[model samples]
Target: MVLNVDNYHLKSLDNLDVKCDITKVRTEVIFRQSNEKIGHGIIIQSKHFDRVAVFAPFSGIIINRIYSVYVERIPRDQQWNEQESGTYWFVPSNQIPELVPISKYSANDRELIGPLVGVVVSKAIRFAFVWSPSLGEGICENHENLVIGGWIKFMAE
Candidate 1:
């Protein structure tokens, strides 16, 4: 998905209302064309599965990688109160155990790593999917650009 500049609304990383360690965050690179680096982004995961937030470093058109596919477009207003309303885009055919390199996983992340489905960018937010070989499936959202810090803690309602 591509978000035009005119319709885009920028969310500030410093102004994030969620409580998280600004220093402990991780950065992911957002590419413009193939191999062309565009910007950076931050991924904010909620302790709860209800909601996730992505922050972009700058204002620009957001594009999803080919590995990721568009499942649906949800309007901010139509969001449901329950976690089930959130979209979890996953493709069974794309499932591959240990798709992410083992070196990238920490001791605590051993059970959390799996094959990546792809990335979807909408409104400056990137929604990523990775299927767990043992578990089931999980999704993460980060800034359209590369994320540069550690996980920020947010109180999930």
Candidate 2:
């Protein structure tokens, strides 16, 4: 199955309000395409997933992610009321750009044109740092240990 992530949206009764821009818009998943000046955005592997999940890089202490996929460094950990809606983070299969590996959480990111970011979806095996709901409705995934203004990486499983 293909992970079409643009159709996703995230909205909360609290302070979380995000929208998925990869499932439909055919986004351009980019990383450090150029401008080596900015670090912590070295995004690579765009063609690996059809849809990408993007969450708010909100400020906090408990940075959560889906394992090797995304990383964030927060300052504190507070119990959120739970997001009402979840958004998508992805690029078009033709817009999937290149990602340069420069450290990890310090690189440049931008938009480019390429193929749709494709991710393999399987109902057989599960992956580490990744989870899919039994109903495939809500997301029950997050990365632990992170700081503020940090970077996150979510790979295709």
Best by lDDT: 1
- CA error at residue 80 for candidate 2, angstroms: 16
Model 2 global lDDT (CA atoms, 0 to 1): 0.24
State the C-alpha lDDT per candidate.
0.26, 0.24
User: Can you tell me which runs of candidate 1 are displaced by over 4 Å?
Assistant: 1-85, 92-98, 110-157
Name the lDDT value of residue 61 in candidate 1. 26
Scored against the true structure, residue 96 in model 1 reaches a CA lDDT of: 22
TM-score of each: 0.20, 0.18
Candidate 1 structure quality by residue, lDDT tens digits, 17-97: 222311111122222333222123222212111122222232342432111111112233643431342332211222221
Name the top TM-score candidate.
1
